[model samples]
Target: MLHEIVISGFGGQGALFAGQLLAYGALEEGWHVTWIPSYGPEMRGGTANCTVIISDEEIGSPLTRHPTAAIVMNLPSYERFEPLIAPGGVLVVNASLIAQKSQRADIRIIYAPANDIAAELGAAQMANVVLVGAMLAATGALQFETLDQVLDKHISARHRDKLELNKRALRRGGALAV
Candidate 1:
């Protein structure tokens, strides 16, 4: 199985972090994985994106011209990546930030109000976590337990207090996926 995905949004939205988590999770499952992050000059509010590929076989290259799926957190991300999703692929949309509806009919679309859900969870900065959860639910790309383990690896002593919140946020996003 091969899964090529792009996650995009503003820098502070945690797009890169989400991709990192997915990469870690896939690696834990013994899958070959690659994660490449990109961001503009301005850090926080600037455009941020990451490409992640998970495969069971040897990976020839990391670049994904047409990804299997896209996790988008804003309208700009949607506009940029929507056309790049493979036919019959999946698109996870953050309805809280994006106003335009997807025009593509060849792929599966899942909408979650990531920002709103994260805000409700009292971890507004975890909007990307919410989308990650939704992607987990929609794609079943990685097991929940795998993600839980990956989450533990990503958390540091300074942010241990947020472990539960991130876990909850991921579950909340999974619920929102459907």
Candidate 2:
């Protein structure tokens, strides 16, 4: 299986971190993977996006013009990547920030109230993690176990106290898929 995924949101929204986690999980699974991140100079409020490709076989290229899945955490990201998603591909939308709907009918769209969901879990800024779960749930691209492992290994030791919140955020977001 091959999954070309694009994750986009504002710079502080952790879009790059989400891509890293996906790459880490795929790497742990022994799948071929690549992660590329891009952002504007303004940082925080500026746009940030990342592309993650996971495949059973070697990837021919890192460039993805049309991805198999897209995780949009804001209205701008949604507007930007919605048209770039492949037909029948999974599109995880952050309904918490985006009130507009995608015009494309060819894609499978999943609305993830990331901010709301994270707030409910008491970590309002962890909406990225929420969208991660929704992406996994909607696309069946990765397992929560792997996501947990990635967090365990990648998240700095000093910030380990928040591990449980991240785990909960992922599980909660995954639950939204059902």
Candidate 3:
């Protein structure tokens, strides 16, 4: 199977980090993965997006023109990439940040209040993780255990204290997906 996902939001929202975690989880599953992030000109407080591809076979391109899924963390991202999702693809949108929805009928859209959920979990910064959880629930691209392992492996020592909160967000998101 091949899964291509794009995660996009304003800078500092951990959009790129979420993509990295997804790629890492796919890698642990023994899949070939690639992650490519694009930053806006201003860097801070600007739009940022990352493309992650996970495939069981050789991956020819890191860039995805039409992704199988998307995690839109902001309105701008939804506006920009909504048209790019393939038919029958899945989209997980952060309803706390994005106010609009995609008009397409061919895709499955999941509205997750990720930021609000993370904030309630006392780790507002882990909104990305919440979205990731929702995506896993919606698409089953990787197992929840895979995500947990990725978090354990990728979270820095400095952020160790916030692990519980992130886990909580992930659980909440997964619940919503169900």
Candidate 4:
């Protein structure tokens, strides 16, 4: 199956990293994948977004107009993309950062306290990983083990030390789905 996923949030929230991880995991799973990151000029405080496409067949275009799933790390991200989610799509929001809720009835929406969960894990930066965990649970796009492998392979050596903690955050996020 082919799936389009969009992840958005403010810069420094690791939106791009999460999208990259998903795309990398899809590749490891033997799927065709593409990752595209888009952002405004504000750097760390600016809006950052990425589109990831995973398919069993060759991907025609990397650009996604309407995605089948979305991970919104902040209110702005949610407001900007929630309306464009495809019918039957699943939207995962970071409840700790996003104050609003999606009103669409045609899709499934999940709100997780990602920031709080990351804080509890002693690594507030892992908030994005929590969202990724929730996305994995909601969409089943990638396996947790595959995600871990991608993280280990792609994360910078400086941050590689935190791999286990990030994986814990993913597991915690996945627990929310249960």
Q: Is candidate 1 or candidate 4 better by TM-score?
A: 4
lDDT of 1 by residue, 63-98 (tens): 798989899998889999999999988899999989
lDDT of each: 0.88, 0.90, 0.89, 0.91
For residue 92, give model 3's deviation from the true position in Å: 0.9
lDDT of 2 by residue, 104-150 (tens): 89988888889998998887878999988988988888888999999
* Model 2 TM-score relative to the real fold: 0.95
Question: How many clashing residue pairs, candidate 2?
Answer: 0
TM-score of each: 0.95, 0.95, 0.96, 0.96
Model 4 / residue 88 / CA error / Å: 0.9
Q: Report RMSD (Å) for each prediction in the order shown.
A: 1.3, 1.2, 1.1, 1.1
What candidate 4 gets wrong by more than 4 Å, as runs, is 39-42
Instruction: In candidate 2, list every pair of residues with a backbone clash.
Output: none
Candidate 4 C-alpha lDDT tens digits along 145-166:
9998998899888888898999
Q: Specify the poorest-scoring 10-residue window by lDDT in model 2.
A: 36-45
lDDT of 4 at 154: 91
**What TM-score quantifies how close candidate 4 is to the native fold?**
0.96
